[model samples]
Target chain A: MKHVILGNGPTGVVAAETIRKMRPHDAIAVVGDEHERPYSRMAIPYLLEGKIAESGTLLRHDRNHWIDNRIELVEARASSIDADAKSVTLSNGEVLPYDRLLLATGSRPVRPPIPGMHLPEVVSCWTLQDARAILDRLRPGAKVLQMGAGFIGCIIMEAIANAVGKTGGSLTVVEMGDRMVPRMMTPKASALIRSWSEKSGVEVLTSTRVTAIEANVPHAGLLSLVYKAKNTKERVQVTFGDGSTRLFDFVICATGVAPAIDYLRGSGVEIGKLGGIVVDDHMRTTAPDVFAAGDCTESVDFSTGELMVNAIQPNAADQALVAGANMAGGAARTRGGLRMNVLETFGLISTSYGQWWGAEGGDHVEVVDEAAHSYIRLEFQDDRIIGATVVGRTHHIGALRGLIQTGAKLGADWKARLQADPNKFMDAYLATALSLA
Target chain B: MMNSLHIDASKCTGCLQCEMACSYENHGVFATSKSRIKVFDFHSTGRKVPYTCTQCAEAWCMHACPVGAIHEDKALGAKVVNETTCVGCKVCTIACPFGTINYVADTGKVQKCDLCAGKPACAEACPTGAITFVDASWTGLDRMRAWAEKLDTNAPTA
Candidate 1:
């Protein structure tokens, strides 16, 4: 058997290892678009914070780990795939044929349509190269501006804030959404995060959009001229929708990320509504002998029981395992993942489990302590905890996930108890889930 | 190498495979609640810290135990809880500053990382090499090597 895994990330690497484990003699090729060893993007912030070296970001510290496993680490951009031909064409003009193909080609940071967005100073904190660029540009007290406050944005924001604080630099975060993490978190939870950021000496601007970014170099009258000075290390200016411009040492554009599937444009594999490769529970795409996982694949949202992309590392591993097993001629099914997000912005911790936003007509219970920066909102579909959003609370996060994932129905009394004190999740779990077990 | 679990919290993914492995090794079933190791997810920043008892040389739990339930195993360098003697007073849980010691309600005894009697299951089960059983004396080897490598930056670029 031959397997060609795209993206060489957590998903692709895990799939390759599993394939090798299942079928030892199988030919495995793990292709990645990066120049360095396969590393985790999740560790980028740690690298930025000077906590871990670049090698620490690597998937495995041992250089021979891949070669020893007989997994070919091919560094090349995947140009396109001929599903009918069962071959993937690389940008380097190499056509690799595979008996089974896994499209783990994860997401690329979404570059907004703002002018002068492609300048060298304006970078997305998504890749290893991006982290290196950021580190190089960042010094103590260096003026840093991050554009976006989503999950990825907040992480980068925290890392940059830490880096800047050490250097006595200023940090500013601009989010176009009405609140931080608008898509994942509720308004109150997002507001709590913004307040937390502000408290941590971060200048957070929400409900604002950047219109254009330009260089303060000579002959840069318009955005195009500023973009023309893209290579210059000149001070950059960001123009807002309100027609006000602000200058920063460097800008990080963490606007968003989308499935990096432009090469799958004409591929027979079905694309989901969110531009992710749609895959079944077995992680198999529409095309036979072809599978998908990680940020690129749209798997089932265990909470909503609908097709959606939960692009977290754990989900990626789960999808990869299932996809690898089935590709290796073993029977396996992905139990799928809930929409779970746990973020630590600066020192404030927040978590959103399952369908954090309440379903229509769903009963919800909330407890807010604005002064202490603590908040909890539990959405119940009748007696079951369908979702929950918690801020500044970390101890019972596992229990919240347990209840949501298990679909544990709180008894009327327990539900009332929870409504009265949302912090009693551990007790609720002990009574409900443990009892049922 | 002195037997000690060198935890690099940065590499944790909150998979809880460690917790399951720990529970399975100790309790004969896969249960995180029964596991000695706990992975705490600090949600706001997306940091998953897998915390376990860092067996102190003069362990706090051992010192705080009323009935001398927490005993130090010299061979393994672990603070093994004598479950038979533990009355679950929950004193050791508070005495331990790291919060690694916990009182199990069912067992009515304190539980903590016993190093699996020298072969910690959590280290073996951690997918990301975040947790590793290493030489207790030189857990800083990796960090030192990192800085040492940086010092020779002008040497060459590969």
Candidate 2:
């Protein structure tokens, strides 16, 4: 048997190893477009923070890991897939035949349609190359402006803040949403994060949008001509929607990302409404012998019976396991994708699980202590916890996940007790789980 | 046959000897906070449950690691973290459902139970036999045997 995997990210690397372990005699090839060794995008933030070198971002540390595993690494972009012919055509004009195929192309940052977005000063913090460019421009007292405060945006903000904090530089973050990390956090939770960021020396502006970015050319005047000679370094003038402008040495756009499935347009695989490849419990696409996983694929959401792109590394690893097993002529099935997000912004840890926003008409409870910067909210459907959001507490927070994932019924008495004091989640979980056992 | 750490929560005394032993074995420290195995004190229920890495067959932390820093120790059947290769992203801490893997701020690396390569210190240091290193295939043998002794074939049906 021959296997060809696309997009040598975490999903591809894991799937390739799984296949090799299951069927060692089978020929396997992994395709990656990047020049660097197969690396994890999740580690890019650490690299930017100077906590680790570029080699630390690699998915496998050893240089000869692929060779040792007997997996072939092909450096090429997949141009198209011919499902009917059981072959994939590469951009380098090579046709590779495969008995099984996996599409884990992952996601790419979306460049919003704003004027001067292509300027060298404006870079999306997505790839290694982009990290290099941003690092090159960073200096002592360098003023940086970043657009977007979503999950990815906040991660990049932390690295940049740390880099600039030591040198007394300035960092301003703009988010069009009403609150920072609006998608992953509730209003109260996001507000607390904003304050924390502010306290940590990051100027956060919400409900703001950058309208345009233009090369900063000093105003044509005698004083401007004199200032231009002193300031030889090029800067960008950013215009906000409210007609406000600011000059920044570098602009980072982390607006959002979408699945890189454009190459699957002609293929028979189905694409979801959110622009992700659609797959079933087995991680198999609509087309036969084709599988997809990772941020590029949409699977059933365990909390809500809907298909969603839960683009987290854990989900990708789970999906890859099932996909690789089935691809190697074994049977496997996934319960579904569960939404999980744990983020640390400026030393403040926050997390959400399952349908964290709560199901419609569901009962919920909140325990907030604004002074201590601690908050815990539990969303309940009947006697079972369906979702949770917590901040400023890390010890045994995984108990919340245990309660939500098991969908354990807290019983009427326990439910009321928890409603009164949401911090008793550990007790509730232990009671329910222990009783069930 | 490989050996596995078997935990008996019912016999736990909450002395925290296992925790101190684990920390000292791995980090050359006596701090309980740095221990890979933890004893949870249920103040309300008056029960202490000691928990650590189960060393799953398909270890989630090992597979979810983007840097492949977590590897299986073939000799001990333990999942060990290579600190030098770890980038301290803390993804493994999330991937672990048991919450046994933890990040150390001092080193910026995640730590978990590696069964002391083969002879686990927690099992050796346990006072009440709450933790023990036993054959992997028969981790439940003692419990099964205890129950078997209770089922007398000659006992009359009530």
Choose the strongest candidate by lDDT: 2
Clashing residue pair totals per candidate (backbone < 3 A): 16, 0
Of all native A–B interface contacts, model 2 reproduces a fraction of 0.26
List, residue by residue over A95-171, the lDDT tens digit for candidate 1.
Answer: 99999999999999998897999888898888999999999998776788889999988866777887777445788
lDDT of 1: 0.77
TM-scores for all candidates?
Answer: 0.73, 0.93
In candidate 2, position A203 carries an lDDT of: 94
Q: Model 2: per-residue lDDT, tens digit, B1-158?
A: 88899888889999999999999999899999999888877775788888777786657689888888999999888999999988877777766655668877678678889898798999999999999999887576444233322311111111
How close to the true structure is residue A368 of candidate 1, measured as C-alpha lDDT? 96
The true-versus-predicted C-alpha distance at residue A259 of model 1, in Å, is 0.3
Chain B TM, per prediction: 0.83, 0.86
The digit string of per-residue lDDT tens for model 2 on A330-437 reads 777777777777777877878887888999889999888887778889999999999888888655555665677667789998899899998877667656754411
